[model samples]
Target chain A: MEILNRTKKEGDRTLLDDLAQKELSRRKFLRFSGMAGASALVISGVGLTGCVRDDDGSGTDGVNLGSGDIGILNYAYALEQLEAAFYTQVMATPYSGMNALEGEYLKDIRDHEIAHREFFKAALGTSAIQGLDVDFSSINFSSRDSVLATAKAFEDLGVAAYNGAGKLLVSADYLTLAGKIVSVEARHAALIRDLISNGSFADLASLAPLGANTANALDGALNPPQVLAIASTYVRNRIIANNLPTS
Target chain B: MNVHNLLHEIENVDPEVYDRLDSRRKVMKRFSFIGKTLALAAVPSALGSMFNKAYGQTNDDVKDVLLFAYLLENLEAEFYKGVVGTFAAIGVPAGPAQGALTVIRDHEVAHVAFLKTVLNSLGVTPPVYTAASFDFTGGNGSRMGPFAAAASNYGVMLAVAQTFEDTGVRAYKGQAPRLINNNDVLTAALQIHAVEARHASHIRQMRRNLASGSLVPAGVTLQPWITLAQSGIDTGNAGANAAIQMSYAGEEVVSQATVPITNIGGAVISANEASEAFDEPLTKAQVTAIVDPFVV
Candidate 1:
């Protein structure tokens, strides 16, 4: 499939080249180190007093969730952290026998993920989750099949997360944005899944066909608890428990 | 409990909430009421009163809804860019299928920007953050290779895409009811939703053809052909051991052995019909739970 040709022709190196540049920058590394140091200091200051409870002490610490919106935002922030950590690790030590093309693509994925993580960080500001230590003990980053399989799972789950969250939005503007982003996530999910299981792209009927499936099932949507299970390993703070709105 | 008993309970205990909802429902019934009142009386005052009434009820709902949409789009944006990035790292050339994916990605970007704009207009603070990274495979604490390893294996990608797209379609459908009051917003969401359906069908078709060599006749025009059968066959989780249960528009339709898409004249199964019936709306809790882990 002449992807290299197409990528070159299209000048779509924004994601790839951008990350590659950061890898070369001493300044970027220093900045990241500083941020890590700051995070440690902040974590220590709030470590004891941050353990807020929901009358049951089951919820995550350091989160002062006042409303349903805050709860939902926290949920999203957690997912972003998982994705960010995964990509960061992927870039740090790419799998063995990785081809140049594969290395390039993985690097791009890392860059994009970093961007997503940072975007959420900026948007959530004080509301965002502190960098929780991620445990990648489950993934085999050295194996080709293992990495792809994990990627597929993450992509599919990510798409479902966005799809599931759309209805909770009341604002038209937010709805529009959700619509736009979900479509992209859908594409990502589709592509990654296809990469994992060739020819599985058109196999929804076997998984959840129409008449048997609602519109919600098509995009791999998932609820908060479900999303939490998938993202749990990557996040240290527990999600503040809140009752989801029932139909 | 049976639906009959459920209905009885709703009528007996929760009459007020139901009645309040029913009263608002009537506003749609009498379309000319607002127009007539404005024309016959003090137009400005009547309009002002209408706005006032709507404003009070909408502010809270709008804030929550907007936040929900914003979060959804942000997640999607991060996911898609992840896809593009992941694939590029691998040697997989952006193929014909990749083009279709690109269109989908563009649409998602547009959705995110549009939602941000909408929230801005509403004077709501948008939650913008970094693009969340993704694990393309189910990383099991082992070293990994290129993100596009599935490119070498057709079964994996098809399964992943089918699941993801099916979820997207269902999620949008599930959310449609909440948006019915705003015609423009509803139309916009559905349009994008439908487009997502098309993407789902294309992926499903590719998988089906790859698996069993079942070809979708070229140039089929039926929406149901693409949506109902092909997309269904590819994305539905109806097996006895399926992790998640599914339905279409509240109907429990079973998955068929094959995509049965007959043309308008019954000559051959058309593509459009297969594409149109790919709708899958999910329950709200199901969606929230699925995305919760990612919510940092």
Candidate 2:
């Protein structure tokens, strides 16, 4: 599990600098796991494990999450695909009683999600995985309650997924890109939350803050596994993230 | 720091010999030096004048990022606290705007607490900027700006909230790359980023709910998401358009990877839809420009 992954910018040194400074033989490895989603554990005196791809050599044919940063990008891309498909359906058959303004918000978000999905596709080019197959059978698109509820869930899940994955990216550009998209997802999340229960947008309890939070000051942050677990219910394909970096 | 000059000596060495040298320290030192030089040369010179002394901190890069966030969050928390704390004094009744503002205020307070905790844990003291440090009315010392009615009026108040929250979202996105090396910081900033986005969205939603007569004239039309129309954002026709421009200046970006999305994706989205779909980043300079007026 990821321990002390929460950096304590000790004076002038960062955790990454410390890790890089340490001698080659005694490497400190960080694995993100615990506290349901946002905790990271630092492990020492061991070989990095559980990072080999589960795919059969060729990564394209199945749910293979390449490796390293590409794997994380693909993970985000996959979620965007799910969101885009979901919104496309929502617009194609809007639930009853969606006003022009409400309908406009949904349409803007749908375009944004589609842009997001395709941006990753262009950015990744060949490294991108096959288009994901979705399962929306459980969601009743005709009902506002069902559509809004499902939309809220997806938006919340997208925000958390990025929160957890931000630590895994090695490239600064990609990290910035992920940050750019995640906030919009949050905006969508807030709108959907408001659409459901007027003031519930930021009312949910957040465990992200350190110390006691009397105001429940933090927000949602889901690890890849936790997100995939929920997303799996909506995605029909068998997703495998074995090659993702844990340290 | 020239790579060619640095590699001259190693060019003659066999691959096997270079591998056995175990010179990780030397290599990292050169790499870091190159990174520093690149960072300096990369930032556009035209944007340099906008930098501020308020955020000038010399600590771990991540520490600086956290403190910057603390400044913005403080500004937001105080803005909300003033109005939400004195709902009646401001001539506003308890309604949806009041309810929405309360929720946003709480989130801002939470964000401030979170940033301070992270700064403390980083072994750095958080800078304190009291609410008196701000001048929301745009009137320093002796006068109040046109938006002084912001607190007294729900419509004006929502306009101010929209600018602050949108800037907050962009500010977080801008600093994320600097904190990327530290996963904990990156993840935390992103979490806050999304919350700010939610704030921006709800503020827009609230504004949209206002009666046409009570609406904030932001020049151009407004939506919950960003779009590529700056005609009204900077036209000064709306409430303090000049002040609000820094927060939303170039938000109307319609291109990604130097190519239009609608051209290739077959989505058939309009030009407005393209920019509305994505939020752009803003540097500390742009943020301080929009925020400093409120911050004394």
* Top candidate by lDDT: 2
Q: Candidate 2, residues A1-247: lDDT per residue as tens digits?
A: 0111222235666433432332121121112101212211221222122122323433543476654566788899999999999999999998999998679789888888998888877766555677877899999999999999899889888888887888777655567678778878888888888888876776556323211133535567777887898899888767767556564
Candidate 1 retains true contacts at a fraction of: 0.01
- Which regions in candidate 2 have their CA more than 4 angstroms from the true location? A1-61, A206-216, B1-59, B140-143, B212-221, B229-239
Candidate 1 on B59-127: residue-level lDDT in tens?
A: 555556556655665665565565556665433246665655555556566667776776788787777
Weakest ten-residue segment in model 2 chain A by summed lDDT: A25-34
Assess each prediction's global lDDT (C-alpha) against the native: 0.45, 0.68
How close to the true structure is residue A146 of candidate 2, measured as C-alpha lDDT? Answer: 94
List, residue by residue over A1-247, the lDDT tens digit for candidate 1: 1111111223554433322232222123223224324422332343222223333324544343222232344455566567757866776778788776456545544443444444444443344445655667888988878787777666556656655655544333344434433443444445455555644442344324111122222334456667666676655555543433211
TM-score of each: 0.41, 0.76
Report the error of model 2 at residue A234, Å.
1.0
Q: What's model 1's lDDT at B176?
A: 62
* RMSD for each of the candidates: 23.2, 10.4
Pick out the ten consecutive residues of candidate 1 chain A with the lowest summed lDDT: A1-10
**DockQ values for all predictions?**
0.01, 0.29
Specify the highest-DockQ model's number: 2
